[model samples]
Target: MALQHFAGRHDGNRPLVAADTVDDLLPDLVALRRDLHAHPELAFEEKRTAGIVAAALRLLGLEVHEGLAGTGVVGTLRHGDSARTVGLRADMDALPIAEQSRLGHASRYAGVHHGCGHDGHTAMLLGAARQLARTRRFDGTVHFIFQPAEEGRGGARVMVEQGLFERFPCDAVYALHNWPDLPLGHAQTRPGAIMAAADRFDIVLRGHGGHAAQPHRTPDVLLAASQLVVQLNTIVSRRIDPGESAVLSVTRVAGGSSHNVLPAEATLTGTVRSFDAGAQDLIEAALRDAAAGVALAHGVEADVTYHRYYPATVNSEAEAQLALEAAAAAGLQASVAPRPAFTSEDFAFLLRERPGAYLWLGQGGERALHHPCYDFNDDALPHGVRWFCAVAERALPMDASSPTARR
Candidate 1:
C-alpha cells in the first residue's frame, strides 16, 4: 500500500496530532507490521524489509538513503529551515527462532520470527514518518532510521562505524522497544543504565582421553568443565559486590558424544550481564581464575576467551525526561522504570555516540520477548506511533515564524 493513504489531514488549529490521527493509520500500519512479521529477516540480511522501508519513505517524499551497514535505511524529513535535527530509530531484524504462533500472518520462513517485536517498531516509526511528513508539525529535521542486525549482529555499532551520525547528524536520537510486562499503553524509562552490558565467554578444557571405565587413566576434561561451571556460577555471589546487580549464566556446554569414552576436550559457553564496568572487569577476571583453578585441579589445560558485545545502555537525564514527557503527551501512562533490564541492546552503541533515550512501550502479553509464541501486539501500534510523533514534535517544536506555524 502507498504510504500516502495512511496520511491524515492536518487541521491548523489542532496543536498536536491527536490519537485519532494515529488511529486512522492503524489498519495500514498493522498490515505493514504483519507483512514484515511474515517475511522475517535476520541481522544484516534485511534486504526486503529495507526495500519496503525505503519505498514507504520515498512515497512520503522523504530523502531515502540505504546500504549503510548493508541493509540499513535512513529517511530524512526536514522543514522550516531549522538546523536542529532529531533521529527516531527502529531496528529491522528478526530472531533466529521458529514462529510458534498459529496466527494467519505467522512467519512464512521456517527458522525466523519477529519474536522481539521489531516489526511493530519499524511499522510505528513508519507510521510516525507518514504523519509527520503529512502534518509538518515539527520544525527541524527528522531522520527515520531503520537499522539492521539489532539481534546480536551489532547493526547500530556498524552504522556508527560507517559514519551514521556523520552523514545524517542528529542533535539527539530516540528508540523504543515493546515490553510485554507492562500493561498496554504504559511506557517506562530511567535516566541511566536502562539495560545491562552483555559479555560472552567461551572456555575450553583439554586433557587426555581414555576409557570411561579407567578411573585414573585420564585427566577428565568433562569433570574439569563441570567444576568450572559451578565455580563460574559462584563468581557473582562471592566475587562481585553484593550491592551491585549482575547475572552469569552458563547457556551451553559440549563434551563427549558417547557414554563409553571420556572426551579429550569439553567446552563451556555463556553470557555475563552487568551495568558497571568495574563489575564486568571483576567478573571476567574471576571467571578466568576459576577456570584456571578447575583445570589445574583436574590436570587439564584451560583456554578462556571473553568478549564484551554491547555496553550498558545509559540514558541522559534530560533526554530521558523528554522521553517520559513525550509518552505523557501521547496519552500513554508514563513512569520511571522500576528497574533496568538485564537484556542488552545495540542501541547502546548509538546512545554512546549521541544524547538519546531508549524507552519501553507497553504491549502486555503472556509471552515475553524472544519467545517463539510472541508476536507484536497490533493494539499497541497506535500508542507507539503517537509517542514517536509526539517526541518529534516535542523535540523540535515549530517556531512562531516557521512555515508550519504560519500554515
Candidate 2:
C-alpha cells in the first residue's frame, strides 16, 4: 500500500488515460480509492491519512506540506511560470458510523466509517495530482488542499484561519461533492446559493414543578413548550412566504422523566435552514417570538439560545459556469440547477475568500452519504479524476519551459 502502488505499473510515459478520453484512468483510481476506503479516519484526526496523501504527492514531485489545523495536507504542483493559481479541495473526514461494506477492504477503524465518500474524493484528487504532475499540461500552480473536519467542525474555516490563502494565495478555488441521488457520469450544479445556512437553537422554559393532580398550582412548562413547537412550525408554514424555502425541524426535546410529576423546565431544540440571510433572520425572529409568546401564555420564564453554524454553500456565478464548462469538456451532462440545495458546507468559507464554485458529481446509484451500508462507487472515481485533471488543464495550461522539479 505504498505510494508507488498508487502510481500504478508505469513508465511515466505510460498513459494514465485512454484513447476515448472518457474511459481513462479507471484502474489506478480504483486501486488508490480502495486503499483509502479500507483505512478511514475521522475529522481533524487523519494522521495516517495525511501521511499517505503527503507521500503520494511527494512521489509525484509536488511540494507537500503537512500539519495544518492538526491534520490537513496541502500539495503544490507547479506546472508553469505564472502567479495565477487554482486550488482544488477535498474533505478528509469519516463519520462515527459502522461500516457495512463486507469487502475484504472495509474500514479498519471499528467505529469510524467514511460513509460520506470522502475517501473517493481524496483518491480522485490524488490521482489528479499524480497524472497532472506527470503531464504538466497546465500553467501556474495547482494547490491540492486536503482538509479535515468538514462534517460539522468547520475544518475548511480552520485552514483559512491558519493563513491558507495568505501562505499560498490562489486566484480561484473549487470543490466537488459526490451526489448519491444523481446518475453516474453526470455533474449537476447551480450558479448561487447551492446549499442552505444551517443553524441550531435550544430553548429551556422554566416553571414551577408540582404534582400532576394539582397542575393549576404550578406553571406548566411542558404544556407551554409543546405549544411552542407547534407555534414554531407555524413560522415557516404560515408566516414565512410560501415562495421561499425554509425548514424548522425540532430534532430534539427533553423535559420530565417521571409519570406523575411535572418538571421545573422543558427544553426544545431544533435546526433552521435557509438559502439567504433574510430568510435566516426571519426564522430566528419567528422562533424568538414564538418562545416568548408561549412563555407568557404559561407565565413561565424562557431562556433561549441559538447557535449559528455553517453558512450556505453559495456558488459564484462566473466560476460556476467555468466548472460547468469543465464538466462539459469531461463529457458530463452539466447544467445550472433550478433551485439551490439546502445542505450546508464549510466550503462556504473558501468561497468567501476567493472566486470558486462548489459542484456535485453523480454517484450512479451509489448509496446515500452517511448511510451505514454506503460505500463510494469505484467506477465514478476515474470520472472524478478526469474532471479534476480537465479543470487544471483548462484553468492553468502547462508551461513546458518552466522549472519542473520537486521544490
Candidate 3:
C-alpha cells in the first residue's frame, strides 16, 4: 500500500507492489484484526479466537492441524506436498488489561483486550497464507503456528512441553511482535540475543511489630524492606558482569495497615532479566545473598523466593539473515540491528527448539501494547503478511539452495 499512513492521515494509501495476489485479501485481514480487537479473548481461553484462525487457514486451502498446548493451531501449506519446510508463528492470547483505548474498535469484552497486538499478528500470517496458497508461489512446505497463553502464562513453554515441534517439525521458524516506538511499516532485525530470560522474585520481610514510636524494641520490617528494595538496584548495577545486559526492578512492595503500628511483615516483588542462563544464575545468587545480607544487617528475618519465567530469545545468524532477505523481498526497508528489548516472550521456547528469530513489528504511534489505551495498528497487516510469506518462499526455495546455501 506504499504505507500511505506513514506520511499522514490526510494522504491516501498508494498501492505497493502488484498486491502480491493477497493484496485483495488485505481488506479481509484488516477486518479480521478489528473483529478480534473488539471481541478480545484471554490467554489459553481463546476457544472462539482459535476456531476463527483454523477456519481462515482452511479457507486458504491449507492442511490444518489442531490440538497443541490446549488451543495452539498449526496450518501446513504444501505446494507439492514435499518434505522441506519452514514455519511462521503468531500468538493468540490477549492481556487481562481492560480496553483503555476506548476507540470505536475498543474491546467489547471488559477486562480482556488484544493489548499486545496479537490480533494484527495473527491475521497478517493468515493473509500471507491466503496469498501463498492461492499463488502456490513456493515449492516447499510452510507451517503456520497460532499459539495461546503468551501473556505471562508460559503457553509457548507448555506447547513445547507438549511436543509442538517434535510432532510438527520445521527447519526454521519465525515470529514477530508489534513495537510502538518505531515508525509504522518499518522493519528491523539482527542476530544474537534480542530478548531476555525473564524471571520473578518475591521476598517477605518478617520482624517483631510494636508501636511505631518504640524504635528500640520493634524489628521494623517495613524499615528493613525499604532498605532491601534500594539495595536490589545494586545487584544488576554492581554484581553482574559489566559487559552483559541485565535488569532487576522492584515493581511492587506491599505490607502494613495503619500508619502508626509497625507491620509484622513486608513483601517485596520484582522481576529479573538476563541474556544467558549463566547470567540468570549469577543474578539469582546475588539477589538471595544481597537480600539476606541487607536483612541480617538490619536485624530482620528474610524470606526470599525466585521464579524463573521465560528464557531469553537467541537468534541464529543464518536464520536471521534468511528473515532479513525475506523482509527485503516483501518490499519493506529492511535492516538488521540488535534490538534492545527487555520484554519477555513465551515464544522463546519455540526458538529454543528450532532455528528461528522472533521479530518486532513497529506499531508507529500507537499507545504501545499492554497500555489500556493501546490498539494494534491494522495498517500493519500488509507488511506483516508480506514478511511471513517472504520468509517462507526464501527459506524453503522451490529450487533448493546448495548445501552451503541452505542453513
lDDT of 3 by residue, 213-319 (tens): 88788887887888888888888888788988899999999999998899889999999988978889998998899889978887888998999988888888888
Show the lowest summed lDDT stretch of 10 residues, model 3: 5-14
Worst lDDT run of 10 residues, candidate 2, spans: 398-407
Model 1 stretches astray by more than 4 angstroms: 2-4, 7-20, 400-407
Which tens-of-lDDT digit does each residue in 108-177 have in candidate 2? 8898898889999998898878777666667788999999999989999999999999887888888899
RMSD over all Cα atoms, model 1: 3.5
What is the alpha-carbon RMSD of candidate 3 to the true structure? 6.0
Best candidate according to lDDT: 1
Q: For each candidate, what is the lDDT?
A: 0.90, 0.83, 0.80
Task: Give the runs in model 3 whose Cα sits over 4 Å from its true position.
Answer: 1-19, 402-405
The predictions' CA RMSDs to the true structure, in order, are 3.5, 4.0, 6.0
TM-score for each predicted model, relative to the true structure: 0.94, 0.92, 0.91
Query: Backbone clashes per model, in order?
Result: 0, 7, 2
Q: How high is the lDDT of residue 202 in model 3?
A: 99
> Model 2: C-alpha RMSD to truth?
4.0
Candidate 2 residue runs with Cα over 4 Å from true position:
8-25, 398-407
